[model samples]
Each structure stands twice: as C-alpha cells, then as structure tokens.
Target: MTERMSAEEFRAIRHEPKPSKYRNRKTVVDGIKFDSKREAQFYASLKQLERAGQVYEVELQKPYALTVNGQLVCTYRCDFAFYDAIQKRNRVVDIKGVATKDFNIKRKLMLAVYGIDVEVIR
Candidate 1:
C-alpha cells in the first residue's frame, strides 16, 4: 500500500529545477529558461542592446554542425548570436564558466571545418 500525493505536491517534486553536473543553477527570465545565471544576465544585456539599436538581431541557442571527412562528428550549440550594428560584424557568443575537453575538441573542429570563430565570455 502506497500513499498518493496531491497535484501540487507532485508538480513540486517533478518539475523542480535541478543543478547541472557542474553545479550551475538554472535561471528563468522573461519566460525563457537559461542554463546558468551568467547566461541569463547576458541575455538581459543583449535585450538591452537590442532596444538600444546596437544589435540588429539576437539569436539564442544557435547550433553549428561539425563534420569531418564527409561524416558528421558533433554539433556545438552557441549560447547567443547577434549582429553588431556598430562593429558591422556578426558575433557568436558562448558564456562559459568552465571549458571541458569535449568543448575544446569541438572548438577545434569548428574552426578547422567551418572557419567560425567562437567568442568565449568567461
């Protein structure tokens, strides 16, 4: 025999946000959920820049596929992408507190294969 919980209790237990493997707590802002507080702050700043017309456009979670020798190796997802109206250049940003070996490998593959330089914000 087991005791049944109410809907709110179930939701509280089931839908609670948990810390990531690196202990980065998730944050929600403007109805958009972000992986970390730093990411969320960056997003807020981007929104401000957009409003100020410094950024022409803003994109979130942009993915780049890395293929080697005609075979797909992996996909690296960027935190944010935007066009700088002042600099007149496109920017791909990754807000990283820690860089893993997998990320380092993916970064090399990205540059070697696509010539895309990822901008890292620590």
Candidate 2:
C-alpha cells in the first residue's frame, strides 16, 4: 500500500527539530551568549543592580579549581560572582534549573575546599 503524505504533513515533519542538548534554549544579548533565557534575565538584573549602585561589580563565569591533597579534582565554574555592596561582601551565584550529580559534587567540594558558600538561585 503506497500512501503519499500531504505537502503540509511533509513540511511539518521536516521542520520538526530534535531535542536540544540543554533543557533550555540559548539566548544572545549585547553580543554575549547566555546559556539560558533565565541566565540572560539574571544578567540583565545584575546590570540594573550595578547601575543602581546596589552591586559594585558583576563578574560572570568565574572558574574555581576543586582540588584535594595536592591533586586537582575538577574546576567548578560559577555563573556569577560579584562584590555585593548591599551585603558588604563578595557573593557567588549559580542558578540551577536542574541540579545534576556533577554540580552537587562540585558544590560540596567547593565548600569543603574553599569555604565559600555558593548561592544557588533556583
């Protein structure tokens, strides 16, 4: 039985894309690419805070090496690190849409090694 698919059906099937690597879609703003729309929104908020003088500085994608006993375990890259004038201290922020085992392990290692609490904005 040879049944021909309609043009509309063929077009729809052709246009259907595979699932993306990440759960969220990547977004670009001001020539900078963000992992997700949520991250981009957060970046906008941070810029607003800096302009409002709430935050002194905003640094993104800061990498910290998680090492143990003179051995490098893994590098934990935080989403945002900044000097918070309101809090009167530096803060590390990592907004997790989905917390994976790797992130959990690295987060624990970060605290155990550096004594820095990563602020997770889920």
Candidate 3:
C-alpha cells in the first residue's frame, strides 16, 4: 500500500517553484499579479476605457462554477468582467496565448449555465 500525504504536504510538493519552459513571465501591476504581460496590458487598456467612461466598471478574475443538481462540477476563472455602458451589457473577457480544451469546455459551460459568451483576447 502507498502512504498517503496530507493536503498541505501534497500542495507543498505540488507548488514548489520551478523554472518555466516557456519565456512568458509573470508581472505585477497596481498590486495585482498577472499571469502574463499581455494580460497586464489588457488590464491597463481596461482601466483606460473605464477612465474614459467607455466601461462602467471593471472586475478581475471573475469566477464561474459549473454545477449539476446542486453538486459542483468545476469552476472557471475568467480574466476580466466589465459592464459596458455603451453596449448596455456585461462582458466577460479572457486573455489567452492559447485556448486549451479545458477552457473551451468552461466557455461552453458558461454559456449554458450563465448565458454569457466569453470574449477572448489573443
């Protein structure tokens, strides 16, 4: 039988810092840590739009949960959510260098569950 590790111990081993194979680096702006520079740039643009009164409000890392019969199936975190006063609707945005299969599934689920179509920025 294999020995079981506690959750904390498993997380400690799982999340240990390691060099990334890709060159994309994490960046911090306005006390927010972004996964990539492209995401940070997009956030800056959102702020500019907000200041210019184009966007009513901006939120970062909006989370959506997929559930069936009150049981949680999964959770998806989008990069940004904003109310577009011009469009008179709320928009969910995601910054992606590449769209993974899991993201596609979550995007579809967001539509089916929340009826929001996620806008992707490559």
Better of 2 and 3 by TM-score: 2
| Deviation (Å) of 89 in candidate 1 | 0.9
Candidate 2 displacement at residue 73 in angstroms = 0.2
Model 2 per-residue lDDT at 63: 96
- Give the Cα lDDT of each candidate: 0.90, 0.90, 0.90
Q: On lDDT, who's better, 1 or 2?
A: 2
Please provide, for model 2 over 2-106, each residue's C-alpha lDDT reduced to its tens digit, 9 standing for 90 to 100.
999999999999999876666787888778899889998999999999999999768889999999999999999999999999889999999888888999899
Candidate 3, superposed: residue stretches over 4 Å from native: 1-22
For residue 42, model 2's alpha carbon misses the true position, in angstroms, by: 0.4
Displacement of residue 15 (Cα, Å) in model 2 is 9.6
* 1-122: candidate 3 lDDT, tens digit per residue: 99999999999999998865555689998999999999999998889899999997688997888886788889999999999989999999999888889999999988988899999999
Q: Candidate 3 at residue 44, lDDT?
A: 88
Q: How many pairs of residues in model 2 come into backbone collision?
A: 0
RMSD of model 3 against the true structure? 7.9
Task: State the lDDT at 27 in candidate 3.
Answer: 91
Residues 1-122 of candidate 1 have per-residue lDDT tens digits of 99999999999999888657888878999999999999999999999999999997798998988889989999989899899999899998889999989888887887899787888898
